[model samples]
Target: GAGVSQSPSNKVTEKGKDVELRCDPISGHTALYWYRQSLGQGLEFLIYFQGNSAPDKSGLPSDRFSAERTGGSVSTLTIQRTQQEDSAVYLCASSLAPGGNEKLFFGSGTQLSVL
Candidate 1:
């Protein structure tokens, strides 16, 4: 896909299990972001990565969640010991620049379900 690509479009796991979600952004994009959106809720920022610099993970719900961007292109989000409440649609987006407003290209998203 020329736009952002996400793998395992849907995931189902038992409580306490671990899952890894992958996102491959468009080539040459410098900024990438992860967001979580539960049913009927708005997008919740999870993390932001800009180039080789440090990532902002303040939006992570808990210490069990972590993400890393490799080569400023592909980013992976890891959730350890998943809970039922963690079920949501995980969205990945990329922008040419970092800011509140930019032309962001979003992926189809990974829907996670914890049973």
Candidate 2:
């Protein structure tokens, strides 16, 4: 992909449904990040993967939320037993380096709605 790519731009589901969001980063970017934006939460950092190892999983709200990166390129975020509170725009971003402030290329995001 020429840039960060997120799939299923919009997802609507009933409460208790599970959802998976995908992100394919730029070919050479080694730092991938997951964030969620909602009117109530603002922008929250969910997780970050450097290469295939995740050094930062602290941002995830609970055990129900998890993410993983494979082959140092693509990443997936899974939300189990969706709640209306979990509805938000899930965003993915990548940077050339492993730092919070590094310039990033962001995907459009997946808007997940739980009713």
Candidate 3:
């Protein structure tokens, strides 16, 4: 895809189950980010990967949430021992580089439902 693509648009899991969401960014983009939007809440940054630099994970809500980008292309977000509060729309975005001036291309997102 020319733009960012995320798989499994909708997911329903039990409270204690673990889930993995995938994101495929644009082919040449060097910067990728993961964010989540909860009901009535703004986008929350979860992680950011830029080139070969260490990822910035300061925005992750909890220890249960983790993400990794491989070969600077595909990224995966994993939630362990998911809770009801973890339900949200997981969004992926990519840019040519990481900076305030760069425009980000975002995926439609994965809607997670924890029952």
Candidate 4:
């Protein structure tokens, strides 16, 4: 892809249902990140993958939330047993590399609605 791309720009799911959000980062980017933005709140870092290293999952809110990057390109964020509090815009960003002052390209985001 030309830039960071996310699928299912809008998703509505019932509480307790599981959902998967996909992201395709720029061709050469080695750093992919996932964030969540809730109403009236700031963007909260969820997870990040850097090259072949183990992903940083410390930012994930709970065990129900997990993300994985495949072949250093596409990434998927999965939320299990969704809750009302999970309703928010899930944003994906990618950078050239990690631990450096590099510019990050972000996708439009996937608005998840947990009803």
- Candidate 1 lDDT, 65-107, residue by residue in tens: 9998889889999999999999999999999888777899999
Candidate with maximal lDDT: 2
Q: Residue-wise lDDT of candidate 2 within 69-106, one digit each (tens)?
A: 99999999999999999989999999999875799899
When summed lDDT is taken over every stretch of 10 residues in candidate 4, the lowest stretch is 50-59
lDDT of 2 at 109: 97
In order, candidate lDDTs are 0.92, 0.94, 0.91, 0.92
> What is the full ranking by lDDT, best candidate first?
2, 1, 4, 3
Q: Candidate 1's error at 77, in angstroms?
A: 0.2
Give the C-alpha miss distance for residue 5 in model 2, angstroms: 0.3
- Each candidate: RMSD: 1.2, 1.0, 1.1, 1.0
lDDT, candidate 4, 9-97, per-residue tens: 99999999999999999999999999999888999998889974545888899999988777988999999999999999999999998
The true-versus-predicted C-alpha distance at residue 29 of model 4, in Å, is 0.2
- Candidate 3 Cα lDDT to native: 0.91
Tell me which residue pairs clash in candidate 3: none
Tell how far residue 78 is off in model 3, in angstroms. 0.3
- Give the TM-score (vs. native) of candidate 2: 0.96
Number of clashes found in candidate 4 = 0
Per-residue error at 86 for model 2, in Å? Answer: 0.4
Model 3 per-residue lDDT at 55: 63
